[model samples]
Target: MLNLVELPDPEPGDGQVLVEIDRVGVNYADTHQAENSYLSPSSLPLVPGGEVVGRTPDGRRVVALLNGGGGYAERAVADLPVAVDVPDGVDDTTALSFIVQGSTAWLLLRRSTHLEAGESVVVHAAAGGVGSIAVQLAKAWGAGRVIATASSAEKRALALELGADVAIDSRAEDMKGALIEANGGKRVDIVLDMTGGTVTDQSVASLAPFGRLGFYGMASRELPQAIGPGSLLAHSTTVAGMWLPHVFSLPGNVFSQAMGELFELAAAGTVRAVDGGVYGLSEARAAHEALRSRGTTGKLTLDPSR
Candidate 1:
């Protein structure tokens, strides 16, 4: 439903500055935005982009995250807080990844569940944008064991290389068994789930006592079974979810701190982006199709200059 029609360039509103975008992050949330199935509501004729790295009028390079979806265009009106100068040594796409995917990965452990050292962690979609980084971060932050699952062996191997203690096929027939087996016959202590449907059901069933699971993406377009009090009471499990826009309220310092931490990680070689590929502005539709195909690995981007 995307049309490459020319529209007048946007002007900065009050407290907003104009940015000539260098790179636009193509997030799974943007795909949901286009389909009108996002967690929140949207009307027709929307521009689909949540994060971008660009230059302001004075030529300061900055990273911006917009919930209003104007980033697919040549320019967007970014305000002070959601817009911050890109750190030294980080590329446009890598900075954009931190705004959404990287921050989400951090909050999944730091906020959603206080990851205790030595706790077993499982990361589904282990080669995708967030999962790939989560695998590395879990290890860097002191996880005892990290289990990574992906649909391909190359991805599983990549997870293993990124410090995962174990890797398994995401398409295992007995999902629960595969996870438990990968953990050396023990239930997982924490889980980060993006793939839904049976993958979620099996993961929930594989939770250890006092286990915690955080849901961020449902790329499979499948919802997990509704949970009841009985399900949690039996094992004392906890479940939580997060959306990035909610964290920007204290924008002056909130997300900025997270970006700083990720930048440090990047500088130390503790983490890096998995470049999925960059498409031209006119090829936004194609990019969404690639995401819907669910075959993309790492982070995909769009070049607004085209």
Candidate 2:
């Protein structure tokens, strides 16, 4: 359904600027948005993209977040405040990763749970755009143990290389046991997961007292059963939900600060978003298919010029 079309160029509104699109960050959210199942509803003639790396009229290369979804085309309207300058010498893919996924991962640790030093942390979808970065950031930020869960052997190896102390199968029959077993037979202090359903149930059960669960996505069709106050009281656990755009609303230029730090880490090669695959503008549908298939790892990008 993501067919190529030509239309009048989009005009910028107040506080926005037109960007000549270069590279688009294709996220799992796009797949849900395409099916009209995203947190926000989609309208007719929707363009299923949210982040991109492009150049503004001033010729400055930047990575931008499109609040209302217009990143797949040759141009998009970027809110100036949400667009940040891409570091010199960074490629389009790395720059784009530093936006949505990178920012989300950083906030997950810094804000979502205020991850404490020496706390054992778990990162589900360990080889994903957000999960991949979260693993390294947690370790760099002083997590005692970083347990990663991925669906494949290759991804598990990648997570291990990215500073994860342990990697377990995400589809394990006894997810909670697998998590505790991987953590040296002890409950974890923090868990970061976009996966819902049974995996979420296990994550919640695997938490130590006063542990926190940072829920971000619903890669699985079903949601986690973690909202019961009674269960929370008994477990001494907390659930913190994260919607990336909402992070921008926090005081003190929350998102911009996080992006700046993540860029520094990425530039230093301290952390990197895994490279999934790149597709052309016309291949947007195919990209979504690959993401939903759960076989792709790291970050998937789109080249609009192709």
Candidate 3:
């Protein structure tokens, strides 16, 4: 049996870094990539992963957000500018989970939505990786109320444990009504939605006047239908899409500054990791299955060392 398979270990030709992966963070993107439904076209037989925590040749632990797929392995090539030093004391697992989801949440809350200290924010799939981190970050950022929507009682409890002020069973009741109850009849200032389709519509409905909605992923695996301009104008709400790759594309110190802020928050324990379980690289198929079945919460990882 071939314990290890060799693929192209192309040298970091220009502004790229060669990383020996220690942990690969599994997300909804990985599940979609495995299913051939990721928004961007992918190369066939590709290694499907978005983020990784690894060590550079200099022995420094770093996190990389790959441009394409290749994180489900022992090593990979990543853009040098997108790689950041992992904060000291932040373990490999947490570091991997924080790069993609944590940075996305941080940008959405701070830059996209411009979340105010006393405003309210609603997060969908609150028990999952991005949502869990978003909930905590929102609370730490001084959101008066953080409402999380989950599909089960267990996930709801987990969201509360992670720092949500209130958890709603999105599968059991009217989302708008549940949100109103959580916010004392006040419309939310921001809605961080990963689940598209009807959930996107509901999130739009739950926003206050002039509120902002940050759309990230389509967790439901369906393309989100358009929110008509008429409806948006009526509500005075604005909707924006967030992809971590875009943030990294900006010039100058933009990406570095954002990553620095996230690492600081993680080191201070203000944003806790929601690592659900760890699997070996050889068990990637099972990890994909677990994510597809929606049977796990928080961040799932592939430990290269087993």
Model 2: CA > 4 A from native: none
Best model per TM-score: 2
Tell me the deviation in Å of residue 262 in model 3.
1.6
Clashes of each: 0, 0, 0
For residues 1-306, what per-residue lDDT tens digits would candidate 2 score against the true structure?
678888789999999989998899999999888889989999878888999888999898989999889898999999999889988978888877779888888988988888999999999999989998899999889999999999999999999999999998898989989989988999889999899998888888888989999999999989776557876787799889999989866888988899889888888889877778889999998998898888988899998878
Error of 1 at 191 (Å): 0.5
Model 1 earns a TM-score of 0.97
Number of the predicted model whose lDDT against the real structure is largest: 2
Error of 2 at 190 (Å): 0.5
lDDT values for all models: 0.87, 0.89, 0.83
Order the candidate numbers by lDDT, best to worst.
2, 1, 3
Assess the local accuracy of residue 93 in candidate 2 as a C-alpha lDDT between 0 and 100: 81
- TM-score ranking, high to low: 2, 1, 3
Q: Write the per-residue lDDT of candidate 3 for residues 1-306, one digit (tens) a residue.
A: 113356776577688888998889988888777777777876666778878888888787899888787888888888887788887788876777678888788888977899999999999889888888899999998998999988889999999998888898877457777777788888888999988887888778878899899999887877666588987997799999987778856677766776787778888878888878999888888887887676788889988887
Q: Candidate 1 or 2, higher TM-score?
A: 2
Which tens-of-lDDT digit does each residue in 1-306 have in candidate 1?
Answer: 888878899888888889888999998988898988899877877887888898899989999877588889888888877888887789977887788999999989888878999999999988888998999899999999999998888888888988899999999989889988989999999999988888988888899999998988788889888565888887898988777777766436667778889999999999998888999999999999998887888899999878
